[model samples]
Target: MADDAPRRDAALVALDWGTTTFRAWLLDGTGSVLDSVRTADGALTVSERTDSARARAAAFEATFAWLCRPWLDEHPGIPVLCAGMAGSNHGWAEAGYLDVPAELSGLADRLTVVPAGDSVVHIVPGLRDAGPDPDVMRGEEVQLVGALATAADRPETVVLPGTHSKWVRLDGDRVTGFTTAMTGELYGLLMRDSILARLATGEVGPKASAAFARGLEAEAAHGDERGLSALLFTARPLVLAGRLGSAEVADYVSGLLIGAEVRHALRGDPAAVVALCGPPSTEDRYRLALERGGVSVRIVEEDAAVHGLWRIALDAGLASLTPTATPASVLTAEEQPS
Candidate 1:
């Protein structure tokens, strides 16, 4: 509990750093979630550093220091792997994004470890495309990698549906690049806080079959980037014309997002391997959309992140598979009820 000493830890630190918050997972050797800390080390949140890279490393280290020695004693020589925005140009000494196939094939040895006191750190690179477009993402690849491995040669589109739902094409062990969609954040803002908020509430879905299907069809019919606005307008018109209920707008919202997602997945990568991660039901809707788009489908199990992190850990020097969970979290099941 010193103010200046290098606080020690015994667990591998797996950080899911994003633009808004930094989620640090203290994991045991066996890849289980032990204690975790949710800190406000997002890029903009730190004002002390002069440049983005310095800011990122500064934010990262501050959050890393919060964990104590007790966890470290139990899991010594802990290696760390960070994903998400933490690897952006603004993040700690950026590790370049790996091409699709190369990443999915499994990077058992391609971990980027940085110097941090006596311990070492690994940063997972974000995914970028050959196109000039600047859409990028990090850490999510670990989830996708996890989903691919868990599915065990299952041919499917691993969609990590989130603030930026990624439709990744995976054929066997190879991830043939992917596309990034801003569906999650858009939906949140539009339905919860935007002009559409007047007609919206927090009660959305568990699997809106009809609404989801309708959205998929709308997107397919509209085609390409324009599909987004078209779908939204269609829903608004439907609601105004008294053809759809207010409650059903959730479906309309869902459809708009998923419909766009399906289109992104089908055209994201030529590899045609899609898997769903993040929120559960969203994947099913994406699957239904894929089938409607004349695409095949498959399902991957949980622990994709943990397993993905494990692969990175092994590369970072994990001699054994000793993993366990310690139920310590910052948010309640309600504030972050999953």
Candidate 2:
């Protein structure tokens, strides 16, 4: 079988390539998952050993090979679509960002090809804000599309939280702009690495204590722009007062990180509803804080990557999500930054 030879596009694959983990999902024509796998084969993970880009791509290919062997034994060839850091500046190859203030529909049919096991693999490029407060995303654009695809109505602001959190504002379906928040890493370090580590020893449970609420209060006062020291102060103040327990302090620390997001980086249209489409735990914390702050919000779904990839794969013509293809809409006139 040749690398570029056409085969029956019966199955679709989606890759959520990240900095540390490479996750792959097999999907049927209707965007349902058939199989999912993760490997220690991310960009930085692969970079530790080899200097060749081709070798790193091979690592991804080999990982996919193991998963697709059975499927290929029957079909011979299948198309895989990827999104996220896998297409970053240092990933397999650069698939550069599409300009932002664009709509979710803009990414519908877009695709980028990468080397795979004698088959075609497409990596989805992230969209970056072109105006001031420049921000970039490699894979979340498709996820955002999934969020909108099943949304109640056009969203005003969509917050996707992780290692690098994003607050994306949309004008109807087209994304107007966004900002990145380092909430995930900051929360992890402050809880485990910093002196604040003394407050907690392990994972936080479902029922967060009063310290969490207190931290949320202080963080709400300062919001996203507040410095690290100030946010951590809530932990110090509570513990010193003999109020927050070692375990309770962990919740406080968690709340501090999320509260800051609610306080800052969430400036969307006053009327736009907030869409929480990431981790449920963080979404829970964000919801409480934002509601308290008088922001109208909704929790869209748990696994945005899968939903986003589903829509992306279908649009890229890899998956049979749609039967009769519709032409891409003429882009709404681009908006100039003030």
The prediction achieving the highest TM-score against the true structure is: 2
How do all models score by TM-score?
0.73, 0.83
Q: How many clashing residue pairs, candidate 2? A: 3
Q: In candidate 1, what are the lDDT values of residues 45-126, reduced to their tens digit?
A: 5434545556567665555555434444566566667776756676665778776455453454555677655556677776
**lDDT, model 2, position 215:** 75
Query: For model 1, what is the alpha-carbon lDDT of residue 282?
Result: 65
Regions more than 4 Å wrong, model 1: 1-11, 20-22, 34-52, 67-77, 100-110, 115-119, 131-135, 154-157, 220-227, 240-242, 267-274, 294-296, 322-338
Residue 304 lDDT, candidate 2, scale 0-100: 73
RMSD of 1: 9.7
Which 10 residues in a row give candidate 1 its minimum summed lDDT?
A: 319-328
What does candidate 2's lDDT look like per residue over 114-209, in tens digits? 767577778787898777567788767877888987887877788887778878888888888888888887887777787788767666555444
The CA lDDT of each predicted structure is 0.64, 0.72
lDDT of 1: 0.64
